[model samples]
Target: MSSLGRHHDPIVAIATAPGRGAVGIVRASGKQLQPLVDALIGAPLKPRQAHYGPFRDATGQPIDHGLALFFPAPNSYTGEAVLELQAHGGPVVLQLLLARCLEAGAGIGLRLAEPGEFTERAFLNDKLDLAQAEAVADLIDASTEAAARSASRSLGGAFSAEVEQLAERIVNLRMLVEATLDFPEEEIDFLEKADARGKLAAIRAAVDAVTARARQGALLREGLRVVLAGQPNVGKSSLLNALAGAELAIVTPIAGTTRDRVSETIQIEGVPLHITDTAGLRDDAEAGDEVERIGMARSWESIHSADAIVFLHDLTRLADADYQAADARIAQRLATADPARLLQVFNKADTGVSAGSDGRLLISARTGAGLEALRQALLKRAGWQAAPEGVFIARSRHVQALKQTAEHLAGAAAHASQADQALDLFAEELRLAHLALQSITGRFSADDLLGEIFSRFCIGK
Candidate 1:
């Protein structure tokens, strides 16, 4: 839809879940909802007050007895005249109420709301900024308590406030730098006298602080994807069951017992870890049948895409030359792909097996020995320190924006530090940095970006 088209139409939707519940709500938003109120409820509604009544169809037949609420324009969620019919929480009942609303408001252009159209309207009407609009969806999808609280903080404008503050500093610095360019001959060094370099340094520091918090928030929103990969029968399934505290993956002594991926999500310190147990890697030609080959291929695929790969080494077989050769081959492939995300773990420590290298962690999945340390190691690899008291939830897009802003600031700093600095280049860098920061809060955003964001939200939100 065009920018103005969103505001021109009246929208209706079932605001509650589809299944049976205590109550269900059918909501309508438009320029004027008094007519709709009169049609559906057969009486006038007091603003912001719920009146117990019967919601009737076009024939004046009672569809459901419920509460009617009316919110006049500029005071409702969408900043428009809104009407809500709270009726019995049954699928058929809600459907009837929704249909009645469409029938009542048909002349006024009332149509079914698109996914996230309600929150999108809130954004367009200045009721909430882009960041806050996004937080509304994040708050709904939050999987952990920490994540929910963090999303709440973002919705409350904590994250946007920080971005605005950074933008203000950049604006001030740009103004100082631009002034120097406008009148080069004019006078006592404007930048030097005003301590422009000192201000730039301070802005850079602030960006770093916000970037750190944003990283933590992103971790909470998009938890680590950890893949357990190693040779066959190396206790990969056992380790998965131990971490999940459930027998999610089948365990057996037979080789190639797990021919597919077994996945589970578990939280440590309020940060989720999506763990996957995959078919073991092997070099032998006679390792498995056709199914096992496909499974191993999938295991490699998971490893390449994972945030972290736990290389489980059977400590008991460390002394065997064949096992050593196979491990060396796998290590070579990992080093070529992503060596930084790999964590060497020696399994079966309860059998008196020890790690050959100091960098590797020794753990016994059977007895749960060293499991806590393993959890901590996984968190460390994922770049999650801990869930701080006031951390906010952030998406990957937010993290990318912060990184881009930081890069621009770094460029600006470099230009500022030159002995024979170009003021124009420095000012341009600051402008770019400001724009990047603005993108986070949607001061400068594209229409397509907004569509992609709100498309993920549930309908009527």
Candidate 2:
């Protein structure tokens, strides 16, 4: 069906999650829901008020006793009339209720809602902007309390507000620049009088600030991928166990005990870290078997892809010549890695092994010593700045948009600073920057991008 036609039709879905619960919601939204309401309840329901009643089938058979709610057009979630049935959360019950809704509204072309269709409609109807619409999904999928709070902030229009404010500033600057573009003789004098350079500088600074916050928010939403990498038996598994507070990885004294990656997600101060303890690093020829060799290869793969690498070291074994040689080899391979993301952590500090001044963290996975410091370090590596104020959740795309805006603003600044003062170029840059900021709140977004984004949402959102 055409997008227009599909969206115009009445849509129904079991609004609650699948499985039994104390209550479940079956919802319908459309331009006109009076016919469906009459077919289901036989009487008009007070808007926004829940009415306790028995939901009957076409044959007048009571399918379930529940609460019914009606929200008339322009005052509902999708800016359309909405109907909600609060019913028992049993799978069969919801399915039957859903079927009944379709049956009753068949005349109105009511159909099952597609994934994220409800929220998408809300976006289309101006009830929510693009960023706020995305927050609906992010809130549902948040892995940590901080992430949830951030998503809630975004849903409450915090992120969109920032973007809109930034866009408004850019628009005002664009208008000023474009206004001066037609008058070549007066352009320089007009811009100088208006302090265009100063305004552009301030806008650039604002973009930078918002971009930094958006980066931190993206970290909370997406989390970090951290890989524990070093020679075999470097206490990687033990450290993983300590960080996770669970024995998620098998820890054995024997070398090559772990032949694959064992991962666990643990939060430190509301930021999730997806920590993966990989099979110990070793020379391909030194691997004990084909499985171990494949495991080592996979470890390298994880190491290369990880956002951060915990170069775990066994303080007890650092003095051993064989271990040193192996550690040196691993370090050589890791030399190409970004130094900022690579952390050298010496383990087994409880063994009384003195860690010399290398400025590396010293910890004992066995005793949980210095684990807190390690967590802070990981957060630092991820560039997480825990603001005292609430942060709105953002995606990588939002970060990219902010960066694009900054780049265009930089171009505008360059044009403005030139001795010749290219007013047209300056205006064009401002226009582009404005559009970039608009894309964040979906004021200017491609149809395909919208589809890809909403497709990730759970059905009925």
lDDT of each: 0.87, 0.89
Q: Which residue pairs overlap in candidate 2's backbone? A: none
Clashes of 2: 0
Highest TM-score model number: 2
Candidate 1 Cα outliers beyond 4 Å, as residue runs: 1-5, 354-359, 419-421
TM-score (C-alpha, index-matched) for candidate 1: 0.96
Error of 1 at 127 (Å): 1.1
Residue-wise C-alpha lDDT for candidate 2, range 211-280, written one tens digit per residue: 9999989998999999999988889999999999998999899999999999999998888899999999
lDDT of 1 by residue, 180-261 (tens): 7887787656557878789988998999999899999988888899999999989999999999999999999999999999
User: In model 1, how large is the Cα lDDT of residue 342?
Assistant: 92
Choose the strongest candidate by lDDT.
2
